[model samples]
Target: MNSSALVKHISECFIKPQYEVEEANKPVYLAPMDLVMLSVHYIQKGLLFTKPPSNSDDQISFSTPEFLESLKESLSHTLVYFYPLAGQLATQVDEARQESLVFVDCNKGPGARLVHATIDMTVSDILTPRHVPAVVQSFFDHDRAVNHDGHHMSLLTIQVTELLDGVFIGCSMNHALGDGTSYWNFWNVWSEIHMAKNRTDLVIPSSHLPIHNRWFPDGHDAPILLPFTRHDQFVSRYEAPPLAERIFHFSPESMSRLKSKANKDHQKIYTDSKRMISSFQALSALCWRSIIRAIRLPDDQVTNCRLAANNRHRLDPPLPENYFGNCINAITTTTTVSELHEHSLGWAASMLHQSVANHTNKALQDFLKRWLKSPFVYQIHQLFDSNSVMMGSSPRFDMYGNEFGLGKPVAVRSGYAHKFTGKVTSYQGYEGGGSVDLEICLPPHAMEALESDEEFMGAVSLPLTGY
Candidate 1:
């Protein structure tokens, strides 16, 4: 099909629901940390799966009406435990205190939205490796999936699009309501519920239930008083030209080689008790160095690598395994362009390792305390700066294991388009092995340079014909 025709086909394809489906429970209030995320966009996650074989005895059939019904029912039941997802964000101003507070209003009626769409395409059309497919873009209803000004914010929106030989389930949730860990926990529990659907003997264990109590240091209000600003204002200060997005797959062997190379390079400089370099650190360092080289930054220019680190285990008293909410902080390391381009991969990796190691429990507590005083001091917008790169998400989240009884996902992605130039998201390869898939967005010229960079190419596996 031609480009316009393909657009028309996707636009004409789906059936909208007649009414909204909400939680089958009551209302709840927002926690302190939840309010901190009120201005960001929704977190979009998509799972693509091929149809189950005809002879299969799985309770949920792929793309069938029975399947959709079971999904909605399971989601409803899942919300009973995760009630905040079914609620809406409500804001109230305290005139006496001269401040505004946002909370989840559970009684606001219509629950989370579930959009059912059908596309006249197959799974392979969009699962192409090394490229972000347009078909994948059509899987989610971007208009309704993201929150906007003046609209009543629904905490969760799910879109299930049926393909000719597969299905795409796209879920968009308000970031203010939860972090990556909480987000995956909700989906895992939903899948568990769907899998346990007609089996009375099967029970979802307590381990899966999300812990809603938001952890906070003593002496903090529900809406912590922090100097804040709108997301647009925050990003406008450092915005750069729009960037192109691409996916790069690194095999387990390649990652091992990269780690080994990085460690060896570190050994050449000074062998103080061998500093352990993790796969993530090695890969991140390599990407950071490659980006600087690709962009051809001036030798004297200063550059920074910012990584999103989960503080669940770094808090004073580590949080619960299932603690539900934003419990992450950005750890950043700044170095000159000369050092990144002139040094070996190990030098960059050591910098990342040290930056990450600085995140102790006291540091996290201090970060929270500082944020309470200066709420608008987040560094995410700095990613758009020409001299900075921000790495977000982890490949270890088990995204491929989100099986809703329709078999495992053939691929998964963060459905929303990343606008920042230096934004990079990493995920485990679809097979659940040690391989990593990097979703990177850079300016057009930078992308071209990265594509041709010899060092970067050495670690990336070329895309197969079918994939």
Candidate 2:
């Protein structure tokens, strides 16, 4: 790759204060409560790949100074980079402190540092999967878990490693920075600008999904709030809920049968042109049951499951396709462990359909609107205190085909590492057409039980989509 062709610039930015403060007085950027949890698997495999880049040529490099300057300029224009600090006690201190962003110059340090490695390339590529696996492995080997308290932010570990065909780039981000989609949008925009490419064709404008400035439970109408100190107090009790994932490739015969059954269930005519009763929902029910049985939950125990719904279309101001950042919220529903385990596949799918519909209904939307306006939100901290599970699926995995033209991703999985409670499961399109890959992370014991369940495996005819 030509040095001149390297579109994105690299800047090793570190957050060092111009004036030092006492350790106790320093402003904490990452609050203890806001850090999203990651499963043990995610912590173990902290570094992993996203959708593969277009270039298979892996000789790693860094972005130029010009690129870094441009990215900094771009970031300065965006509100997503800034977060609101709650409480009047911290307000004055936060205002006086420097903005969280900083740039570290790695080229200097003089004298003895002459033989040091200097990576060159654009910052956008820094978010790519190339070098992440090794960086994660290094963190694992050294036993450096993310700091539970202090300045919370994402970290990129770009290194020259022989394991990743010599040059690989990896990054670990604070879940608070943004959801996966938002981060990807940021990277794609950075890449286009760095390469001096025409972004008009590739970049989606901001008008689509406007960033929300209000606190999550904004105003007097806000629906839920049980404010507390300490992150563990807020999230620790939520139990690991049940979830399942897979891609079902329907044959013509199977499709006909499904359509016929769906029509009979609805007592209405159906057309093949439009999909009916999302197949994803059907599959999820199956997977959830397997998970439930494996866990051996009590028959009457109510298990809550939710599908994270994007508000791109639902919001009064519809979020644009490329409006990047977290623009979605989840619609939660509950069912008994026994109910799920004993139900037929279709029954499971029906419940999922109704649950999602109920939550997304106009009444629900009205409730949320009123809730967001309220002074206090319902304090349902108990929801987080119990063992819970959340399963999510989106057709957005089609974005994995974003190869810059290299090829679609062979596999795509969400990165998670919540030490305490909650488990997440996701499915992404696989490299092979007509197939999708799945990844799940949970407690060590939970993972072990599922892996060993013969009955569960036999029922779904589980396919091995290796991690």
Candidate 3:
């Protein structure tokens, strides 16, 4: 095996939809809410599968020629349901108003991208380390490009990397195209299609079809115009400081205990079962407190933890659970370090719970309406500060169920897309059943400080190893 080169690219090809896209669906209007994320990095995510048995008389492994063909063909069929993925971003610049508009041009014959690559390392080489190695990022090539760059590049890119002993299927999805739920939905359908092997008679059922209609505020229309004419005005690009990314595994018991402690002290506050503290809120609060303590932010200064809230269910008459595209709203909670020191764990967790619970349907509408009036793209620095924690991703996503001929995934990992100092992502642990893998990025000193904190480290399990 060549150690000098970690990842070797084998081939690259564009996969178009299996059938012709309807002319009516050729263009997808960019909603005001979707444009806010146009400049953010594409979501870099992938999974690791167990070692494949050598070529045998009967078994067809994931890397087998027959299986690879099925996988590619399955993707083509999956694209018909998710037609916007097989397109490029289009910009409408208005010189008169100094505003630029972004939308999806889905008619381009060249659809989504698929890359075939190989790595010299084994599964052990990746999962053995306490902190995941940086080479894991090599499985993806478009991490550095923002979603706005999708105008020329494919809106969705998939890279399949064959390891010395295992395989990794990495996906780089444009943030504007979909959120985590939509992303996993596409993969799940693709895997379903691949289960038939070479069969072409299967088709996505109408019930499973994704709703592409962009959500809009009342009295507002699509193609939400941006205030700036150029990408440079809003897209944030700067040299980030050195950082360490680590994943902390938490068992169901630990998560439950955290939730219990948080809810114990908040009974008098909530008094309602519907407003009970959740494992997510408790765990997130724990991370936020530990990071602030590790970084030693001034007690007098204010701090914040911004959470990604899915609004599909929060709307009046609630959008369909399968509603595709970005319907994510953020909940930012501010507090002082001294207040955190004086409060119990439950108190901090309650702040998070309340922040989310308080975001009513009217609030969701108001937030979007305000953004529609004064549109601005999300900037990197806003969430990149070491003093704050920006938590995205969710433990509810079926990360372990993405099967494509191979067995269940051994672990789930993300690439270097949104790896800022305080960025955090939570994945459903491979063991399943309420287990969670908490991935966080921080400076080296702060990471070390966190690992040493007895109160925080006590609830976390050891690093992941191939089972």
Candidate 4:
């Protein structure tokens, strides 16, 4: 279909819930981490795949109606294990304590919203590697999917869009409910249920059941889980104008070269034990340097790199494998543009490595303690600056493993509506075999500069034809 026709088809599409899916269990109080995420918007993800063929002559084909029924059934079954997803976020005031708190009202009513939509476009039409696909934005229900009012919002919304020769399953979940790990755990289990055809005998193994209990140091008093009042507001004073989104693929070989270059100069200065740097650290350093170069910032200006570090494993007496909640904290490192430009790639990489390494068990515990005392002092503005960049998510999240009976997704993208300037999200490349794809959003001029920079372009592989 042509672009205009695709737009027409998308406009003609309609969405409605297949059925009500309520929680199969009781209500649960919001954890401290959950309260911290209450004001954040939903995280959106899309999975695209070709339509599947029928398996049996008598069995119904995977048509729109049949597929919708199957997906709804599987989702309802999956919610049995993940009950909070079907619940709603409600605030309750403690009269005796004169404090207000938020919790998930698992009343087993007004379940998650699952909408069905169809468009006259193919997956190929929306796979442009350099640009954010328009269809990707059309596949989601952004306004209704997010709880901007902080009340009466469904915990999750799933939109299944039908394409000419493919399908797009878009999911939007409240960030206050859980983090990416919890989000993917729900997705993978839902896929498992769908693959099993919602059989009653099959169940998500106990090992994968989500643990809801919040973990704290022994004898430590738990703080009140209330909304942030003053400092936690998202300040937009430093917000830049709208940005352009682009995708760049890095092959394993290019990544290897970057790693080698990042460690070459540092090897002589440090002992063997401390000489090595991780792939993520090296690539982040490269990205930081490239971004600064592309933007042509003043040499004396200070630039920062903020990384979202997962604290699940970093905590002392690590949380359970299935602990499902926000366990990530941001670690920021800063250097003058002059220092960064004058130093070798190894220097930048070493700084990043040490910044992350400094977040030990004690450090993480100390952060939690501090949070308990003042949860509202943080503002989104503090996490970002006009001259700085932030990187979230990981390339190792198994994004391509979500197969809902049809097949593995041909491509997966983080939803576009939620993207912000200077934000970067990393994903395992669909080409597989450990390649990395960086989805970058920046101003138009900066994007153009990065695309034209010879050093930056050298590490980015040529776009694949089939997407």
User: lDDT for every model?
Assistant: 0.70, 0.37, 0.82, 0.71
Model 4 ranges with Cα > 4 A deviation: 5-26, 53-62, 94-98, 143-150, 217-223, 227-240, 268-273, 377-382, 463-467
Off by over 4 Å in 2: 1-162, 166-177, 190-275, 361-388, 393-395, 402-409, 413-416, 419-422, 432-434, 443-449, 452-467
For each candidate, what TM-score against the reference? 0.87, 0.55, 0.94, 0.88
Among all candidates shown, the one with the greatest lDDT: 3
* lDDT for 228 (candidate 2): 32
Model 1: CA > 4 A from native: 1-33, 56-63, 142-151, 197-201, 221-242, 377-384, 462-467
- Model 1: per-residue lDDT, tens digit, 379-408? 335334767787888887868777888787
Q: Which lDDT value does model 2 have at 284?
A: 56
Q: Number of clashes in every candidate structure?
A: 1, 59, 0, 0
**Deviation (Å) of 378 in candidate 2:** 12
Encode model 4's per-residue lDDT on 184-252: one tens digit a residue.
888888888888943688967876788766565555534355543322242122333668788788887
Clashes counted in candidate 3 amount to 0
Q: Give per-model CA RMSD.
A: 4.3, 10.9, 2.3, 3.9
lDDT of 2: 0.37
**Tens digit of lDDT per residue, candidate 2, span 357-440?**
665436445755653344221122332323445564454434343332223323333322432233444444343343333344
* Candidate 4 similarity to native, TM-score: 0.88
Measured on C-alpha atoms, candidate 3 has an lDDT of: 0.82
Residue 250, model 3: lDDT of 91
